[model samples]
Target: MIPGIIWRVLLIAIALVFAGVQLDREAGKTYPLAASVPEQFRSASQFPMAAMALDSDNPDYTLAEAERLIRRRPLPAEHLRILAQAQFAAGATDESALTIQYAAQRGWREPLAQETMARLAIDAGDMPEAARRYAALFLRRDTQDALLEELGPMVLSEPGGAGRQTLIEIVGGGDRWHNQFLRRGARVMPADAFVEIVSATVANGSRYDCDLLNQLERGLTTRDEAAGEGLKTVIADQCPS
Candidate 1:
């Protein structure tokens, strides 16, 4: 007859081996894609549902899985983003909005979260908030030019000027993106509005190089000669006499 302690040891070993085999099987199912291994493994280790959270086609399932993952220690921003995205897709607008804010609070550096925030703000008719979110995105070199191109016209046409001014005040703080914004504004904005923004930036101690001025002049010139001359006059007057 086997000793009770020896039998207990054998049973414990079997249970551990079974658990290991199960874990290995789960890992295989979760990690077929090499690219997702590094990021997804960390989440999967803490919450077994991470695989479904990331891979599920149904937004409702993804949302539920992400919520489960987030309940573990050190809430993952990526999971929060997944939750927010899934919520948005599932027509849970109010919940998605709140979840995205939680994600953004975790880190504003994520482009998708910032974009989602901006879209939500736009849907809420909050242009300033939208511009603020885009401005944060504009700070990223990869996204700056494309966003400037995409949003320049909208800013130029912003009614009440509040949204435009908000962008100017933020982007005008000597970030490299503002130069392109001004150049694009010169072509797309009404001459008066372009001049006013330039004058305002100058008043706030921002200086444009001759190249930028020359580019704006050329862009305005190709669009309208009278407007170009009027812009040149404004530039000259705004400069030290």
Candidate 2:
């Protein structure tokens, strides 16, 4: 009753006819005798570093190289994205999904990896997962927080969409870290659009603590300082007294 892992190892050994590779237990790695290894796999031996030099954008070549690379050795987790993207390019849906799952379990969340997973999820018609992955990639503290000011106008359009709702919640929250950017957003975004978001958030029953409300009141004042007459009217009507 050999375990599945042992069976896989045995199968791999059999595939290569038990070629002149030995596990150097002291060093904890398998060392292959080059002469006994098949010619096809000889180049794969260089892949620990060579794989990084490979052109990842060429679908045909990348798919083939990545496929062969994974078959011969366990790659570094950061490099697994090349394999995942290649698998998707080759239309190996199930294999790509499994590879992506494996990469996640190993804690690989590089930008390219996130993009690969998102693409695969979209290709598989898993919109929720795709959207979730895409959102996760951008919503991190380092990524989104760095550009919180820039995010305001980007999410201000589409009058009643989820993006607007999210902006509303963010603006009304106690996190002052982005409050200045929120104020900047209100000033830079169109007066009408900014007013609409504020009014709707208040209308929609988004409760803000007194401190945040005070901040918002001060924020809107500056936002109106240079606003046009119409924008000033809208702000005065909706902003706190």
Candidate 3:
């Protein structure tokens, strides 16, 4: 009887071990592991591990190590953006600009990427390109005037504010450079006063109707109260109730 019990126990143990092995194999098939690191860089494994460290909120020395790896290997756009952000956080504006530009040139036209390019252009005194990029993004009609407001100083500092006005007129403001005049009247003028001009044109019924009122309302919330009230008076006087 004792021999039979031992035999049964051994058989069950073998079966359990076989089942566990099969389960592991199935899991491996379902979720394949990453390839083994090549024998090139002495710290090749550290790159991804550093990235994981960034994600895990336990960067420790990983950020410094990741910077070294990036300098050596030059990661792809996704990783490059992370490194750029890190540079930005460290107040290394030039390094951030270069890294972001590399990603942008590589066809990463994300909003953040585009904004970074614009910032780089502004930093390099390339006002025309900065204005062009900002206009292209503004025409999407998604960004807010706060961003334009932030860009005002740079635009005004440019040669005669030419690029800034060009961006404003492109978005639907009328000719004769009255756009800036109107924006000033509305008290919404920024360094790039064209944004205000375009906003006024849209708010004043030159474009779509009540459907755009929501956007106008959001703009009003951020605009000068006096300007907003004046605009409301104009709408009440001009547009039908």
Every model: Cα RMSD to truth: 6.5, 10.8, 11.1
Index of the highest-lDDT prediction: 1
lDDT digits (tens) for residues 50-121 of candidate 2: 253344566677676676666656556555666776778777878877887777545434555555665666
State residue 217's C-alpha deviation in candidate 1, in Å: 2.7
Query: What C-alpha lDDT, on a 0 to 100 scale, does residue 126 get in candidate 3?
Result: 81
- Provide the lDDT at 146 for model 3: 73
Winner by lDDT between candidate 2 and candidate 1:
1
Which window of 10 residues has the lowest lDDT sum in candidate 2?
21-30
lDDT of 1 at 83: 75
lDDT of each: 0.65, 0.52, 0.54
What is the C-alpha lDDT profile of model 1 across 127-222, one tens digit per residue? 788778766666655664565555545544553376668766875676566676676566445565566667677767777765668668877877
TM-score-based ranking: 1, 3, 2
Q: What's the true lDDT of residue 163 in model 2? A: 54
Candidate that scores best on TM-score: 1
Instruction: Give the deviation of candidate 2 from the true structure as CA RMSD.
Output: 10.8
TM-score of 1: 0.61
Clashes of 2: 0
